[model samples]
Target: MSGAVMDEIVMDGLRIDGCTVAFGGLRAIDNVTLDIPGGTITALIGPNGSGKSTFVNMVSGQIPPVAGRVVLKGQPITGLRPDRIVHRGLARTYQVPKVPKELTIQEVISVPLLYARSDRPLPSGVRSAADLAHYCGLRPAVTTRCGQLSVSDLRRLEIARALACRPEVLLLDESMAGLSLEDTDQVIGLVREIHVLGVTVVVIEHVMRIIARLCQHAIVLNQGRLLAEGAPQRVLTDPDVREAYLGKGFTL
Candidate 1:
């Protein structure tokens, strides 16, 4: 899909309104509300316990929100099954890439491609499992078993699987966690490519440099609540956001 076509297709991407998730009396996400505009890259950043992963989980249907609505393209999808959510044009990857160690990379990517059904067609250039694998930079290792791949390759495979779902919105949870600088750059480039295909991307990352380089907008959460949001450079320099990460007297 061309960027211009994607822009015309996606208007209101995803919205979270008064969403809350609690675990045994403790709220991981507390009535937080946010909007992720379609066809744009947005960063979801925060301190360790700021509920970044929890928020993604809630939106992707891994966990049900105790109180709130998750709307995608004007339809409510708060408590749907994960697969249902995927079919609804939303998909996500995990902080840890979980795959069957015995499965080849192609096999893993094929699972979603074979089953995913969406109103929108698969992005241009991604028609088969091999094409998806190549798009994710895992073509050289296409036949390799998941357990035999490096961390970077595993991450790429996870992303390929998500792309197979043909999601209008893709949430990447800490996809670059343990990669080397060079590997990180490659993954960043891959993300940019995905965005160009017209997927609205929500990335959860701690690396400020990556967020600044890749995202047009940034949202910060502190203790399960929104602390700051705006352009990357401005949000990173917000007083509250700085304090949330580096105590009360430091700036990033």
Candidate 2:
């Protein structure tokens, strides 16, 4: 290589540039590249084993891509560590919510805030741990132990904990995985409310109704590549998208 330098492009939000991740001979994510606009709720949907989780991991810096890079606002952030990523205004939730069995709901919210960068932007209702609990619909069981709360409440706690990080970009990974219909609707509304509070949100969800309700933009991934992306309604109804991923039954 010569002594050549590349200039950075001013991007509006998180940019994924030709990111690739492979395991042994299998490519979990194939040279995937896209941008997530700030201050909007975008839905990421795909069938089983379609690389949705892997993509979220790459963006959150949980696992670095073997190739390409991730940039945030013209900065080459792929080199930064995960905590640094969080401090730079990026945070994510997991598919399954877990907490110390001994920790109460209030304590669980406090732990992340204690470690978070003080300069990060605190989301709505984060002034006090109890305030966040109430915001997340955990007011009735504010002192409940993690192991004691119902599964749906546990899921709600995950979002509240992530918010304590005061992130500008929040990635939610299957946060509604095991919720009932009514609970799912409630969670969906909560997500929208969070977005309205000025946080850019990306949701990794399989629930079509939830996506249909919350997102105007949708990115569909199949076999670890960019399959289709655009308005959720149009992309979800594309012939190739329906045939290869959604099946014939799925339609607007």
Candidate 3:
């Protein structure tokens, strides 16, 4: 399926071409580059203010890059509007699920489906979103208001909503934060299921266990620069990663 090309959508694997983003006087993403292979999960991790979220935002079009570009399927998409990027088959989820407090889980997911279709009635995919919510262990909370939902359910809802967009590539920004051990495991499984459905994922997380379990390839960033890239275990164990995490006390 990776070899099959989808019409009008560039599926040539997601690539970042020397991207950089700065705020005020500080560089948030410093000439960083990476690739998220089609049908694979890539994890990016870094300490606080290390540029993980900044880079993801730049690629997802929430923030414009100061230099370089974000490419999908071999086409340049950097600095495009968020809606335009969504039409390009890319969707992003935030650490906190941006649910409307007035809406039920069903309504929250349904609204996006309505907007995606515009003049037409809601599509059959609305039911698909429900099923995805169920599979993600959110069925019991289906009618609950977004304000009443727990952190895990909120994360599930966000993932379901992103799935409703029918994206080829999904950017998950710290989706596992503020969850219990059991809830985290459930989310990790749900992510695996999503990948099985052919959506390539780029996950930016600080939780090491989630990254190790789900990411086939890992990118380690420190102070807004690439520190290491390789298999999960190796990248996590790299000297620079240890130093970044533990400062001078980190030792081999």
- Top lDDT model: 1
Error of 3 at 236 (Å): 1.1
Q: What TM-score does prediction 2 earn?
A: 0.90
Tens digits of per-residue lDDT, candidate 1, 1-252, equal 798765444346888899999999889999998878887899999999999999999999999999999989878999999999999999999888879999998899888887878767666867788888887888566788898988888889889999988898999999999999998999999999889988899999999999999999899998899888879999988887888899996655
Report, for all candidates in order, the number of backbone clashes. 0, 0, 1
Q: Which of candidates 2 and 3 reaches a greater lDDT?
A: 2
lDDT (Cα, tens digit) per residue for candidate 2, span 28-70: 8999888776667898888888899999888888878999999
Worst-scoring 10-residue span by lDDT in model 1:
4-13
Candidate 2 C-alpha error for residue 103, in Å:
1.5
What RMSD does each model have against the real structure? 3.8, 4.7, 4.2
* C-alpha TM-score for every candidate: 0.93, 0.90, 0.88
lDDT by residue (85-118, candidate 3, tens digit) is 8777788888877677988888877766655533
Candidate 3 runs further than 4 Å off: 1-11, 117-128
* Pairs clashing within candidate 1: none
Candidate 3 residue pairs in backbone clash: 12-73
TM-score of 3: 0.88
TM-score of 1: 0.93
